[model samples]
Target: MMKESVQADASALDGPALFATMSSMRAMRRLKPDAVPDETLEQLIQAAVWGPSGGNMQCYEYVVVTDRDMMARLAPLWKRCVDSYLATTGKYAPAGMDEAAYGRMVAAIEYQRDHFAETPALIIPCYRFPEPRIDEEGLIASAQALGPAGTEHLMNTQTRFQALAEGSCVYPGVQNLLLAARGLGLAANITIWHLMLEQEWKETLGIPEDMRTFAAVPVGWPQGNFGPVRRRPVADVIHRDRW
Candidate 1:
């Protein structure tokens, strides 16, 4: 049964302000296999839906997966992605990232990939589109209509537009979910590398290829604690009114 509180806006939940929970939200990749109650899961979903959407038409939806067998099935796909990334990239560290820290992060993600089946809940967040957004034929048409240079620009625009649209519609909800989970003392993380095998994964989930999946989020109790996260100072990344 669904909880009454889930129906109410998370803002009026009579607890901490949802916005304040952001600082505590961290990507908790290492999780325990303990089961999470549905009512609690309901809170996360409710909070996710409260996120802002264009014209108030909330198009984001989530598929909550808790069965370990299903996760086990995804393990090989996840491994393929991780191995591909590690092999192609040579080094996992991004520019300006400390080699040691990035190495540790890579190791942790590798561990997460290896033990994905142990995760308690796998949330697949998607952007439900009305029609084909990334059709190859459409790109070819655009390429012919506009010159090749212009076609590249057109295609870039299309990709950017879709990404921006989906990001605007889906990421806020994902943020809300992370915050909600944090408030409830649960841990979660989002990964998109698995999309390398998107076709097969979508088939496994019974989701149509046309519907775009934004990312896969796994939620569970953490084996590690959420501590103060390190990041570049605001002064470094923040731009004033004019850069």
Candidate 2:
């Protein structure tokens, strides 16, 4: 009877414990260029594989690159893409900002613009399907799994919902990799710029034609201090039951 009661208490504690573990994982920036050891990286990969996948398909594939020559070769493409993003973003700059603040912001942007290749390691996550047609079936299965619906929605609506659900599975795997790195005293950030250059990057990395790149993550020990995260207030984001 005592053992049974203890087991019940342990089960009840699980949710809060999991939430606390997750909340403590802060996103880190300004990582040092020291390469993460091979064994440590394998542990992070193992953690990521445990993340949920649609139909347990485990469709994701990852390519880890630490080669100096390859990173140097790819650096120019990343710089060009980031520069373009910054140029476009500048059009939306706030009015009446002081010159000093504006200059600091531009400098920060420029630093990040050039730093991708300098990072110690880059991991590219990709997904592959047996065939392109399977994408449709996968979409349907993902949506129906969402929850009960009284009636079938339009195809467009279902597609959007399924994309969201599928994204949830893939991103958590990325998050697992990041958090596991943090626990091991490393820093990482997931970026999409490499995916933006998918064609060129795929050719350079020898990624198969069937694979689709999802994200690019740079990992290393931290070079600078972490700042507090800027976010909306908890009340703004949370609701008791429904909005």
Candidate 3:
């Protein structure tokens, strides 16, 4: 249930102010170790559940970890994932990012990795899709309707398709959590390093065998400031009516 105080405060933001809160929301990787209150965390989760999910099923569940011992146990797994990412896809800065900026970003990532055990709180968002309900006859009919190429496409892409479908429902709630964090002056950022060792994480956190965890978000007071996020100009990316 949403706390009265939390709902009132969140609801008090005017449209422009809310947009400003979002505009300045940063991926705050360098976080202070100060404890966040339970009420504050509850407020964030309350904000999250308000987001819409497919069919209003609202199957998402959150695991909040504030125990230092639990974080310590998870730290080595985090290191392996971060190390793997750095060695491969994250080896260098992308085009247009200057080396200095990239270096700072990498340093922050390393800082977060090194200090993850000290995180004030971590939230793991999870969901398990209900079993697909197509009857055998309907399934056969659908397969026949698709013919060879479409059937092959379905076979090839089913896992990816379900992942996309599931993420569509979960990510909006995650975004709401981030935005609420920003509004409350708490720093939070979404990270998916847990996916690299997902089963291990699930076992350690005692998430159910059937659930799919999406993101590992660290929340705390920030060691740095939040400001406008850099992005390409709107004209460069927008296509009105058509591409």
Candidate 4:
């Protein structure tokens, strides 16, 4: 479909239509090699900015990569990350998934990995936190009251807290981008596989040294159809008033 057609169709989605779009979104790993227009990409980012951020700081930024040569450069890095993941976390089927289902998912990932250089565009969502303003004296006093063991535990978990704070601002926007892509008839999936070689990715893309990328979303026309996404039943996961 043409870019103009995509934009028009995306904009015309009503409330129910929007919900329908959200319900049908799937991680489309197998994508066509066709180019995505810059205008459509801009619309996706525009949708992303509409999402809220922590304290409304809006610190997120996007790197829209359309250059096939650059993708070729990053393809080896992508391979290393995918290889590591496949050998480790992705090696076995998860608890509820059957081996066949897991194998199919792995095949799609391998397909995307091998064709990394051919992806039409990759959108990387990045963020960098500003210098924090906090009362150091009060924090030190609280830590001291907690004693040595508590202080050590807090120190060890500090990095994790910082990462969660950063993700709180960036991931909402990433979800918006994904939803926008689905609405526009484009295939897109959010993946953090690049975090394995984040520093190299930053250097390659000219992202600032301090900025962190949260996801690498490959976007293009899909080779297959988009349909309903299967998930656990609503009742199976919900907590009414408390867990």
Candidate 5:
């Protein structure tokens, strides 16, 4: 598909309209089979490229899959990943979320697992740089130094900061794409459960072994409506000088 460029005024690109789009860009799972226009897709990617990368070294690659046969080949593996992910981690709900909310979340995941093959565009965001690996020696040992949950807390902190540093290079692009698609009334999903079959996918798609497949974003027109999403108050999330 030929990517098209969109000409937008500078104000529109950075104004409150962008904020509204960003806030409303929900994770769309049950996407329609209707194909996203190449122009829109291109625009989204263009927006993505505008995102900041670490040291301005943007080492990221995107594989946009639109072929139906490839989708068919991938869907079964996607379903398998979904099943594995749910069986192991889905039962663990996050803080402040109810059981009903967790169930709905699982249902949405299952929806994509079942219908990902029918998707119009399957965009894989890859880190062209090296993938990070957690070493056992890097973990904090609390009992060796501090008491209580200090070790656990320290380990969690280290992992989070490490992942954040790595993800900061790629997810900015992903977020830009999401906001751009939302502004254009396109539905897109962020799916990564397929990592379970990462090797098979890489072999089939001929992706380089060193490149990290960070996310699989499937884009299309929505089977649902845009949202006025729920979020916590700014005061609750923000800290002025300290946490």
Candidate 6:
């Protein structure tokens, strides 16, 4: 069941508002084996391309994988990574976790590992950079706007700031892609596990040497009812301007 908070939030939003649409941003795990139509997938990608890009560079590209052979080759690597993650994080430990929660995690991981090829569609998002170089002019402009001391502090954190800015641009496209899929009654998940087998994936997927994969997404129809998402209370994360 949807939580009271979620229902209230949904009710408070104006009909057709972006916030109401985004309220469905929960991770969907169980997917039916039915394939998403190619045309539908293309429409979703078209919507995703409308997302903002840093300096209008639009450095992103997406690769779709539907070949069973490729998915078969990639599944084992994901299994290993999933096992390692679960073990390291005590996902298998019986200490404080309830049996149902632990069992569900195990089952979900196993199902994903075993049935990845049946996902109907997979999308890999990649980013290409011209070359790795500091934006000196941008730095100078920011420094001039902020003055010497402020500039020094900003420059000290420039790398982190740049990464955050770039990721902000890219991740929204990912969200847009997912929402587009959901609007079509499809379920999907954005995964970083492909990073564990990045080299093999790049070789197999024909990813350009200059491009880097940022995320892998599996999309299909829902196999079961969607679960309510767990989250911290809005009061905990939201604050007035002073905060």
Whole-model lDDT values for every prediction: 0.78, 0.69, 0.88, 0.88, 0.78, 0.75
Candidate 4 or 2, higher lDDT? 4
**Per-residue lDDT tens digits of candidate 3, residues 1-243?**
211111122332455788778767878988899999999999999999999899899999999999999999999999999999999989987866667867988999999999999999999999988987889999789989999889899989999999998999899999999999999999998989879999999999999999999999999999889877655554566799999
Clash tally for model 4: 0
State TM-scores per candidate.
0.79, 0.73, 0.88, 0.86, 0.77, 0.81
The residue-level lDDT of candidate 6 at 133 comes to 62
lDDT for 232 in candidate 1 is: 55
Worst 10 residues of 4 by lDDT: 1-10
Runs in model 2 deviating more than 4 A are 1-27, 90-109, 130-153, 157-162
| Candidate 5 residue pairs in backbone clash | none
Best candidate, lDDT-wise?
3
Put down candidate 1 lDDT per residue, 21-69, tens digits, no spaces.
Answer: 5544668888888999988888999989999986577777788888778
User: How would you encode candidate 4's per-residue C-alpha lDDT over 163-218 as one tens digit per residue?
Assistant: 89899999888899999999999999989989999999999999999888999999
Worst 10 residues of 6 by lDDT: 1-10
Q: What TM-score, to 2 decimals, does candidate 1 have? A: 0.79
- Stretches off by above 4 angstroms in model 6 are 1-14, 17-20, 90-106, 131-142
Question: What TM-score would candidate 2 get against the native?
Answer: 0.73
Off by over 4 Å in 1: 1-20, 131-156
Candidate 5 positional error at 128, Å: 2.0
Off by over 4 Å in 5: 1-15, 130-164
Model 2: per-residue lDDT, tens digit, 138-201? 7677567764452255454866775565576578888889878766778777778675678999
Off by over 4 Å in 3: 1-15, 140-152
Q: Scored by Cα lDDT, where does model 6 land?
A: 0.75
Q: List the residue pairs that clash in candidate 2.
A: 32-223
> Over all chains combined, what TM-score does candidate 6 have?
0.81
lDDT of 6 at 193: 75
User: What digit string (tens of lDDT, one per residue) describes model 6 on residues 1-243?
Assistant: 222233235452566755555666566667787777889999888978998888778999999887788877776777776677676763554554456756885787678767876778889888774454659897677778999998788869978986677687678899889888877778888878778778878988889887888888888888865444444457766788978
